[model samples]
Target: MSRLVIAVFWLLHWLPLAVLAPLGQAFGLLLYVLVAPRRKVVLTNLRLCFPELSEGERRTLARRNFAITGRSMLERGLAWWAGPARLRAMVRIEGLERLNALKAAGRPVILLAPHFVGLDMAGTRLSMEGDFVSVYARQKDRVFDRWLYHGRSRFNDQLLLSRHDGVRATVKAMKAGRPFYYLPDLDYGRKESIFVPFFGVPAATITGLPRLARLAGAAVVPCVTRILPGGAGYVLELGGPWADYPSDDVEADTRRMNAWLEEVIRTMPEQYYWVHRRFKTRPEGEPRIY
Candidate 1:
């Protein structure tokens, strides 16, 4: 079954962007009507995060997000199997010098990536620049897992450590000069997470970013990927290296992280990943939002 799924995506890989673009939008609309559970999740997230938006406005954003999500799924073919020249042409990178400066200073860098629809585009495009390492939870299905791992690591000298490897392994890799491509936003429960204000909602955010950066003596550079409408392309934007981060207060750093992510989401409302149950873990005595 997994192989069949891969074969479908592989076949889609042969299609031109002009064809795939509108097809993805139409598929997304179909999915919005068909996938009730996920549609509820997306709307629930948007309502909690942006209470100021009118119900109609929020609904519009929800639909657009789904379309972008669908496009991202279909576009994975280009990211995974496309030629180097083709992939390079599809991506326009900004603030790359921020990362380059970190490398020049002999400082290990952590790419502070948030959960966005175009995240894969950012990682794969940047992989072409230099060797980098990222952490991912191993998927359950065996055949598809192998395919995913290979597809992501195939581009350049990229290394993907499983989440089971823990922070010690990540710190070691960063110290060894492999820039850590870190995705800081996600609901992983309250184990290593602290309740922080994400869009004024208390969200369970991982503190691994600050702790790992502090332990590895690395600099944190924010990276964002914006998906262009109608399958035009994507832009991988890098920000300046953070100074005074991972300070004596871990909670403060985590709060700052969430605040920064919220500001970015405002710029491109629909591009942010909204299907996630971001506010799933609530404060003590509080009810669940999803």
Candidate 2:
């Protein structure tokens, strides 16, 4: 089944974005109706994150999210097999000079990427510009994993460190001039994660952002990717480096991270990855959220 899916992706890569995007969205709408379990997860997440929204409003948002999620999945073909010139034309980057300035000054940097639908597009586009390191979570399926790995690292000297590689290896890579593309928002269980108020709910967010930044003496820069509507393409926005981060208090820094993420998600709630069970790992005697 996986091989057949990959084959389909390859065949679909030849189609223009104008044609491909809507087809993907149509497929997404089908998934929203058929994939009841995942559809529930997306709705649950939206309810938790946006309680002020009416139930109808939340459902509307979830449907749009699933559509974009579908588009992202199908668009992996472009990231994996499209020509460099084609991808460069499709992904527009902003504020890259902030990253360049930090590197030019010999400062190790961390590109703090949130889990947006356009994440892979942003990473692949940046990989074309220079080398960078990111953590890779091995997928259970070998065939799909191989294709995902190849798609991500097919560009310039991209280094994908395994989740088990630990902090020392990642810090070393950062010090050696390879910016770390770090995604620190997901709920990675209780270990090394603190309960931070995300959307006014205690979310188990990993403390790696501040720890890694302090260990590698790297500047933390926000990297957000927006998926343009109507098959227009994507925009990867690189914000200026955060100042006075990783203070003496780790919990405080983690709270700051979550607060910043909440603000960003408000800008484009539909683009955020809401399908995941972000609040799965509850504290102590708390009941399971999923």
Candidate 3:
């Protein structure tokens, strides 16, 4: 089944953006209507994060978020199967100099990339520029796992280590001078997580970013990927490295990371990954939010 799905995606990779864009939106609308569970999750996340927006406004954003999510799903074909030249032509990157400067200075770098719909596109483009190591969750299906590993690692010098590899492995890679592509926003339960205010709500945020940066003596560079409307393509934005990150206070550093993420989401609320159960693991006595 996984092979067949990949085969279909590979075939769809040939479609021009003009055709795929609308098709993806239509499919997303259908999913919004049919996937009631995920739709509820999206709505729940939006409600929690954007209480200032009216219920109707949140609903509208939820629908558009699903649309972008679907488009990203279809566009993965481009990231996975398209030629480097083709992919490069579709991306407009900002702040390459920041990354280059870090590399030139031989500073260990960690890209604090949030969970955005265009994240894979950003990673694919960034891989072409320099080598980086990142942690990835494995798919349950073996065939899909193999496809994902190859698709992410096939271009440039990239290493997609399993999430189980933990901070030691990632820090080791970063200390070796390879940038770490870190996405530490999502909730992975309370084990190694600290409750940080994300959009003013206490969210179970990972402490890995500060821990890894401190361990590797890495500078934290913020990275964002925005999906262009009308299938125009994507923009990969890089911000300057944090001045005093991973300070003596790990929880404070985590809170700062979430604050930055909130600011970025305000710029493109619909593109944020709202379908995730971000607040799933609540405080011990708190009621469930989703």
What are the Cα lDDT values of the candidates? 0.86, 0.93, 0.88
Q: Which numbered prediction scores highest in lDDT against the true structure? A: 2
For residues 262-282, what per-residue lDDT tens digits would candidate 1 score against the true structure? 999999989888888888888
Q: Flag the better candidate by TM-score, 2 or 3.
A: 2
Give the distance in Å from residue 46's predicted Cα in candidate 2 to where it truly belongs: 1.1
Prediction-by-prediction clash tally: 0, 0, 0
Clashing pairs in 2: none
Error of 3 at 145 (Å): 1.6
Q: Please give, for residues 64-165, the per-residue lDDT of candidate 2 as tens digits.
A: 998998999999989889999999899999999889999999999999999999899889999998999999989999998998999889988989999899
Report how far residue 121 has shifted in candidate 3, in Å: 1.6
The worst-scoring run of ten residues by lDDT in candidate 1 lies at 143-152
Candidate 2 wrong stretches, greater than 4 Å: none
Q: Candidate 3 residues 1-290, lDDT tens each?
A: 77888897898889987788777887788899999999999998888788899999999998999898988887778878888888888888999999999989989999989999989877888888878899878889998887777767877788888888777888889888889888889989999998889888889988988888888999999999999988688899999999988899999998888888999999999999888899998988999987
> Candidate 1: which pairs clash?
none
